[model samples]
Target: MSQNIFIIVCIIFVGLLIIAEYRAAKRLDSGFLKWVAKPAASLAFVLVALTGGALDTTYGCWILIGLVFCLLGDVFLIPTGARTFLAGMGAFAIGHLAYVGAFLSTGPEISGLFLIGSAGMAGFAILALRWLWPNLAEFKWPVTVYSAIIAIMVATSFLAAPGQSSAPNWVVIAGALGFAISDIAVSRDKFITHQFFNKSWGLPLYFGAQLLLASSV
Candidate 1:
């Protein structure tokens, strides 16, 4: 019961932090809030996972690690620079790998749904790369590699969705899809157009996805 309470509190806290982060980045243009709230929001998910007993199982442990890396990515993205952006991307790439590891650890069955999902994810990756290729500039290769990693992560999530994983199938699929879609917003904001519109949708989707994954623990 206490654990459930803690999870609820953390969820509320994370939601508020995400709202504050959006305001800081878009409306107030406040660096202090952006720096504080973004990482705080990420950390709240980590706490949620811990409170949910994430360290008790192999799948949960990998998810915990992924969340930590995503937290680092959030921190790296708080500052504005090419190097920092690259660093942030690298961290997120690592986080995606950790998620892939978590999903693979589930020993998912190789079913028709899994094959279809994998193919769809692969096609999405191809289309996304084509869309972003022109504006990627010097970061083209890194972004391509990162895109591939996330695609694989999503594909593996599909594999883990057949009641073989610690998380419910719907939760696993929704979290992965949300996370992947949110990245499109991020990519558009960074490489195509620098606008608040991107964050309006992306931040919520990203945080929600993280929260869902945390809850799975």
Candidate 2:
């Protein structure tokens, strides 16, 4: 029941955020102390991930530190939404870097890794460039930003790639892909056209990614 409530609260929180950002259409700066729940939630989430023994091994405590900043970025950057969003992106980027370190990689099956991840990346790129280009043409500056995110996501499956005998290769791949899917869903929420998708697909996809990420430990 607690887990269920947590999920519900998360859904409501994100939904409200989307609504608030859209309605305000202005970036709001939350002073440091004004928003504590985000960091608190992130810390609790990491604690749960650790205690749950995600990915069959221990993770660096530093990742929690990064996530704390991510929550801060998310909460504060919602108004103008650009810089703060980018800050959150930076936080996640660093967090992924930590995951790369925590991952005692056995070198991914380059054959499968390159083939799948590259293909998805290429597809998303082409689709975005060809079909969605004009829709986002005004925000050309952010093209690089989205591109970097794609690059990181393609490495998503790589994080779980068979680490130190305890980490199975398949599990790593699943976890990475799950994370990618969540980010993809997040992109859908931000760029795509539809609130129903945000509620139905984005939230669930993010949870799926988080679940898979936890499985990594």
Clashing residue pairs in all predictions, respectively, total 0, 13
| Ten contiguous residues with the weakest lDDT in model 2 | 30-39
Question: What TM-score does model 2 achieve against the real structure?
Answer: 0.61
lDDT tens digits by residue: candidate 2, 73-158: 44543333666666666666665555554443434444655566667766766665554455554455465465555455455445
Model 1 lDDT per residue over 45-163, tens place: 88878887789888889999999999999899877699999999999999999999888887777777778888999999999999999999998999999989999998888766423
lDDT of 2: 0.49
Cα lDDT, all candidates: 0.82, 0.49
RMSD of each: 2.6, 5.7
Q: TM-score of predicted model 1?
A: 0.89
- Which candidate ranks first by TM-score, i.e. highest? 1
Judge candidate 1 against the unseen true structure and give its global Cα lDDT, from 0 to 1.
0.82
Best by lDDT: 1
